[model samples]
Target: MTEFDEILKLEIEARKKIEQAEKKAERIKQEGIKQAEEVLSQVQKEVEDYRKEKQIELEENIANLKQELETNFKLRVEKIRGVFEHNKERLKSIIYSVLGFN
Candidate 1:
């Protein structure tokens, strides 16, 4: 065969190799994109779960605070009622003195 024919054959073979490399690169790119999408989906699910957990925790804390407030208010009201009963006689005497209702 002539040198020119040999060179032409080499050029064609090189072109075929380059095409195969491009196809392989395209396949790898698609695979990478699919993997990234899967990871993103998983991360989104994890974030949703974390949000639900935090919401439940917050609700529990709010309930606890409300119960504590109610308990404290009841205790304070009882103490005030006791003081009023203890001062009832003095309060009556003061009222009569002020209005001259003795």
Candidate 2:
């Protein structure tokens, strides 16, 4: 072949190699995007799960605090009631003496 023909053949082969490299780069870019999307989706799901778990724990803590407060309140009320009961006779006598019925 002539030198011109050889040069033309080399140019054509270079272009084909460049086209193949570009196609490979595009595929690699697409695969990277897909992997990034998958990782983002997984992270979002994990965050949602963690939030739900924390919410449940918070609700349980609130319930326990409410129960503790209610128990403390009931105990205080019972003590007041007992004191009132023990003083019932003294209160009645004082009221009667003030009304001149003692």
**Candidate 1 structure quality by residue, lDDT tens digits, 1-102:** 999999999999999999999999999999999999999999999999999999999999999999999999999999999999879978999999999998
Off by over 4 Å in 2: 92-102
Candidate 2 residue lDDT tens string, 1-102: 999999999999999999999999999999999999999999999999999999999999999999999999999999999999879978999999999998
Model 2: what TM-score?
A: 0.81
Error of 2 at 54 (Å): 0.6
Cα error, residue 42 of model 1, in Å, equals 0.7
Which portions of model 1 show Cα errors greater than 4 Å?
Answer: 89-102
**Candidate 1 global CA lDDT score:** 0.98
Residue 13 CA displacement from its true place in model 1, Å: 1.1
